[model samples]
Target: MHKIPSSEITPEHLFLSRRQLMGSAGALSVAALLAACGVRTPGAPATDTVPADARTDELGDPLNSFEEITTYNNYYEFTTDKQGVARLATGFQTSPWEVQVGGLVGNPRTFALEDLLAFEQEERIYRLRCVEAWSMVIPWVGFPLRRLLDVVEPRAGAQYVRFETVFRPEEMPGQRDRYYPWPYVEGLRLDEAMHDLTLLATGLYGRELTPQNGAPVRLVVPWKYGFKSIKSIVKIDLVDTMPTSLWMALAPNEYGFYANVNPAVAHPRWSQATERRIGERGRRETLMFNGYADEVASLYAGMDLRVNY
Candidate 1:
């Protein structure tokens, strides 16, 4: 996801230029903001609050808040329709859930979802962007993906890791009898899988995850397109080479492996050069890491991003 390059993103580039465009250059569109499932309104009292953890930002404020953690999600398995997941996920069986780890790892093990909850769950308020173009500021609850991998211990041959959701047509009606692939598959490079930015969240808010939000357990790849962050994860495998992801398999060039939040590289069908933010706050200019670049960009130093992308 190498962006078009800063020189190409100046004020004159009309496609997504900062010029006097049809809409305000630095704010969210009213309609676009409304369509987002996670957008929140200001003055909204905390109906569901997670007390702030001790881990605070430079300002000494808690890193995450309950309202920001659970209220926002983009899980599509429960339903393609935005409001559907949050509603349907209530019936999800979280207590019986288990995460399966296998493939190119040394400590391949199957642990109950409860086992994952034993760690120190901290909050990280991250700027999340959906491939569809809408975005949000969410505080997530979970530990680094490497923490999970460390226990299972990926083997040397684990060049790529693949994730899949549990496919129960009875519960997950999206398992089309045809038309769509059942048990969607998503993958990540060894490096990306182990990145500190990746999270394996067992719960959001102070409660368990909602079905629509990959309830039992889910992968949170904040920088990659939402699809790369699969929901209701059931199987995790390590492969010797590149693994094809659902979006990539469906349309390769549209989603490159290095799906970094780059503003320069435009999607063939859409313009990611800019994004529409939601919540009563309105839209704002999208930053390099959704504003986390200064913290995560060094991971891609010498590589030819355009090619890997």
Candidate 2:
């Protein structure tokens, strides 16, 4: 297993951690107020949260703490490499990096990353499974994708959401070779896109995203393989139909859009039951949704995930 750096808490990381500190505390207060008002908040059962609920491991992977997201990842398309993301991405022009939301929206508009960041971004420490077979427990820093969708106003016909990565091959060497379709494209079903678990991330390890890790912006889908969470995006197009995903287009049977982590629905050449955590000890059995089943299983209620997967 890869040795995860210890607490990778930088000065910026510290700031992000502090920000998470504030945000979570704020959320707690709100949830408390809602309870007082007889309203329900979406989360786990415990008013007294437990560390086990968000642990990313063998039998009990948990949601991310602020510490996880700001520190770990392998989003190279955003930068040349993960380490480069730490240094080069600092110069990233986030203000100009806007998300061109179009396709199936009532009013298609471009949203700047800066503005999007203003939304209630939180840290979700999820089990990140890369197509390469390695895994990581990442605490991604971002807000739910559904919040953005609410603003875009998807038309009733919108059934799929397409994500387009930055296409400036000159700036992104990976694009030059067309290792992918220049701009990496990924799609999600409407309900999946609207899931609270889905995220549009901007930071990890408590700092602004490093380019190596898909700087500027990226997507996080806990239920799917890592490839589905594209980085350095430039556009988000919603349509009545499904768009192509890199991994799925790369290998149909192996990578599906509904790439839910189910122990029963094994990858063509791999087992979904086990996983290797980034910077951790040995590989361990992966639970459904990386152990977030209790929190997210109902989202797929009555659906044969194994078939779709």
Candidate 3:
């Protein structure tokens, strides 16, 4: 019921740094022009189409069109090509989906799709920065992961959380070709899993998640690169030791266990100093912890980020 406050909303006259409005047009007119052109500051959207009741916070950048965000994505289970993954994911069924929680927990259980949705939902307009240097602003509908984890309380020794994606080569074409590996896996520290910001997303753009975008359920950790938020999750296991992520197993040098968004720590293949926002024209300076430093900074105090990354 409470709305999450965001950064001060920049006036329309100030939103466009790349292009200056000519003449003595009033600031309100500049705002209208930008609205007509579908432009906003950077990470937030100018016009948030999501219903006011559904939203807990408004992003500063304009929301990417649903078509652009959903159709253009990286779901390796379907296909490697961004344009092709959406079509390939259509064959998968999600209505009766179940998520099994186990390992080092006091009460392990399997929850049906509707069961997860029974909890209250909130809309969070988050900046999804990809490891590949592209990003998008998405309005995700879900509840804090801590709510679900509480149902299956972690034991004292549980220090990490491992996630597994559904493995179905028959339905997912990429799995058949042995792209990266079948049944994509990812993990996070127990603290990270319980973070208030972490979400178990069920829908986006005010609707159920499409198969291509990890239908049924998925993890959304805004501070880390997009890959840390695994898709189409089927299992969550609390473990004493850190779990191996699909990207870490595939290329540990390029991807790290923490995977926090840091402009200072560059991926082996590319620099992390900047990111290209999808549908936007240019790159923006990458922020520390993807602009969530105030919220999650204390989680990693003495540890060197450059090495952990």
Which candidate gets the maximum TM-score versus the true structure? 3
Query: Candidate 2, TM-score vs. the true structure?
Result: 0.71
- RMSD to truth, every model: 13.0, 17.3, 15.3
Model 2 error, position 107 (Å): 1.7
Score each candidate by Cα lDDT.
Answer: 0.70, 0.72, 0.86
Q: Is candidate 1 or candidate 2 better by TM-score?
A: 1
lDDT of candidate 3 over 180-200, digit per residue (tens): 766899999999999999999
Between the candidate structures 1 and 2, which one is better when assessed by lDDT? 2
TM-score of model 1 vs. true structure: 0.76
* Model 1 C-alpha lDDT per residue in residues 1-309, reported as the tens digit of each score: 876977765454566643546567335676566565454444355545555565543423344344444445555555676645555566766668778889878878897877888867876555567877766555667888888888888777778888888887777666754455667888888888888888987666546666666777788888766677788888988888887776677678778766777666667787677776644344545556556676667878887766766
lDDT of 1 at 89: 61
Clash counts per candidate, in order, are 9, 21, 8
Lowest-lDDT window of 10 residues in candidate 3? 46-55
